[model samples]
Target: MSAPADSSALLQTPLNALHLELGARMVPFAGYSMPVQYPEGLMAEHHHTRRSAGLFDVSHMGQLLLSGPDAAAAFESLMPVDVIGLGVNKQRYGLLLNDAGGIIDDLMFVNRGDHIYVVVNGACKHGDLAHIQARIGGRCTITPQFDRALLALQGPLAVSALQRLLPGVENLVFMTGHGFNWNGADLYVTRSGYTGEDGFEISVPAASADAFARALLAQPEVKPIGLGARNSLRLEAGLCLYGNDIDTTTTPVEAALNWAMQKVRRTGGERAGGFPGADVVLAQLDGTRPLMRKRVGLVALERVPVREHVELQSLDGAKIGEVTSGLLGPSADKPVAMGYVSPELAAAGTRVNALVRGKAVPMEVAPMPFVPNRYYRG
Candidate 1:
């Protein structure tokens, strides 16, 4: 999460009042007054979501629609992902890149047949909108749906709770979505989320968000989750948080996100090299350019919580890297972190030290998803 801005100037989501009513400890995040945790506390919320369903008010995220015959091709030019090849109703995680191959922001886009729907980070929305408009607005009609409220119903039992409210939602496998009607409100729901769990992200009308959230909370398996648990959950899932783990300075290849780029966008494919920084990204992918550092997962041998910005050093005390995100993963029952390290030291089982208050805390590079991802593919 970004640093707390001026609380007085923070924007309020449609569920703000409901959050207050539920005794949430509000904090300023991404320019919004968001719930950090409710009366049940962060640990409870975290465990609850892991065991059942957790509802998150992600309405702060920017939602947009790009229409016209050129929408797909136009969007494809902004990122390495194969937007043109995306089938209708399919959703894909994407990175918006700059000319130098650094990530501008990470986003999710869905093929809506007539229009391409895009959702961007809350903190980067304004700039993202401007960037897309300036780059592809002439090729496609860009419509920003900032008024929409987005809710993520996530966990092992997420589908059970949501399907009860909106029948047929269970039919949406991971990475797919469809439009639905809920109590006279139109909703576009995708069976996807940041928490690496089988979940659904519902785009509901802002006006009806309160009632919708309350209804979901009424379900025995569903509970309100806050940003605190959301962060830990994503960290445990090995998912990168936009500003924390990725930013304008991080390239997709160096960030270990090569899988997000399809073959069509790689060097030998038909539609390769049209995106911003395509040369740089593709070179890193094909090994024509050497990477200085690589993102890797780390698990502390001790129980100490290693946090972001903590310096990581080699066994011999040579500075090797810095932690980008870390915590005592509630689910993993151990302290885990992700950071960039010298390429030679990025392999799993490589031992390192996280300097906490000048003490060397031993940590070993490990495979990610500190907790195994439970995405429903069937």
Candidate 2:
């Protein structure tokens, strides 16, 4: 395992040199040096991704393995998702909860036979590991896979570009995963990703990451994307970012992630719903009391991009909501955003006003996926 750095000065991934060579404007994000945008700027990068293909280096994320005689039992002791029932190679999106039922973080768990492979947010990696460690109670082993690099190939042309190199990867359906060899490097490829487009996330050894990324970019349709475009792309796709979209202050029900919870977990024995904060989480499951509606898509009428925590109000002056993630939608040619609001105002088409730079900006509650998701859901 690679130990975390002692200082906060920006860490670099294996692809750091590749990004600099492309003339990307490097920015510090989640304690790592990352490209915020390229010579094309954020707007162009955003548009290019929607129309073509974009490659992203997400190696800053933490990858880990949990395996032992009691791996499944130990896993169920922490997260709200069902680990025992997860079929091999299937991926499940779930949340890590505090004892009070508030989400500590959201993560993806993949069953890799005897052990489970986990990927967590980069910013919360250390805390997440500590949380899992303290609760496992000698039932399982927690091994951090710092030697791996994660890459996301997203957008309409993603399948074509990746298939051109890997040959036959286009057969993977969404949320399913498999192991493959690419240019002498082993990869764990998943037909799923953060951006709401047809894509794959490939996990490879850190040493081979840069070369693999360069190979993918060598294709005509693929371009190197930066964090700036990645943020806008996910927002447009209606995906949530940890820390901003959700955190320890919110529940899955409020975040509209109730579907991620298994039915058995909701009704099984005392131990079934026995994870931390089960009372609050299960209560939200039983009835819709004290709902904290997660914001979906919002269309800003003004040119300025609405940012986080901006107050939202009704046309008649009644306070309505606040923005969580808002920005210009280069694809829609308008500004878009998302925020929490009273349930009554959470319905689609509800008219609202965003306090943008102190002036009222007309906006509306629109259906999410600001653009339709092109995921290969088969």
Candidate 3:
């Protein structure tokens, strides 16, 4: 795992002590001293999550709450997602955009009945907080839950393991969340995760985080995983990593995230073109503006492991784009990647080459979710 140059200034999560006790290799990530892998190794941890359940400590991410009668409507004005139309106890993927339609950050927001619960990437939490407060602070009250700890139990057996501790959790379908009580602690759990698996992400108070993690780890089907496996898992699922795949320079249309924008928010819908960059985004959606580049999935024809920043080129050697994320997928058992390319070359089965170490490695544009998603939507 690559870490920042200066690791001394990193913050520690509530589970830091437990991670050390469990023999995890700590590394600097997003200003935190996080576990990159455990003694079981990245490969083992990656496979464990695919076959059974793997517990992850994601406390470094930001959690916040927006409360007010106007919270939903005010929040909807910041992004293209239909926050006002979202049902209570349901969640939706959202993008925070700048005036030019470039993605400022990508996050998940859940309507918790009384308030909106938001989770942002650890690296961008501070910025996201200020952005939200500055844009919609007048319409709603913003509260940051930075002290809470989050845990993800992801895999095929995740439901069975989690239900033993919280009996009714199995009833929550994908993209939904519910408040629950566990051993006198207030918990907010959502049936969603970065990995394309049946999973749940639980938000517990910082004080009880260690105890809660231990309890979940005690389940026979659960094992501790780290950031290394987490990246590979999400990559196999074709999910975007904020800074890597999408950033302040990328737009929703260019990133192939049109599905995240509902019809109600699009042009001709009841509430159209109110959010930041709506003019640019709506134009791209309606085919008025042409796209120069687009994000696409790629599979290497050779056994070589293509990595990020590798230049993508046409069959005859014209530079088209570059890889944003790539790895030899542990489950897909091949080199898979997500990158940007000329719109004309973004289709599946389109042949291309990845310039790795001055050599041209053959590749083909492929459909995303390199592996099939196993989300329990029902």
* Residue pairs in collision within model 1: none
- Name the 10 consecutive residues with the lowest summed lDDT in model 3: 1-10
Backbone clashes per model, in order?
Answer: 0, 2, 0
lDDT of 1 by residue, 164-227 (tens): 8999999999999999999899999999999988899999999889999999999999999999
In angstroms, the error of model 3 at 334 is 0.4
Better candidate by TM-score, 2 or 3: 3
Candidate scoring better on lDDT of 1 and 2:
1
TM-score of 3: 0.99
Query: What tens-digit string does per-residue lDDT give for candidate 3 at 37-62?
Result: 99999999999999999999999899
The superposed Cα distance between candidate 2 and the true structure at residue 18, in angstroms, equals: 1.1
- Model 1 segments more than 4 A misplaced: 1-4
Q: CA shift at 240, candidate 3, in angstroms?
A: 0.1
lDDT of each: 0.94, 0.85, 0.95
lDDT value, candidate 2, whole model: 0.85
How much is the lDDT of residue 14 in candidate 3? Answer: 97
What is candidate 2's TM-score against the reference? 0.93
TM-score of each: 0.99, 0.93, 0.99
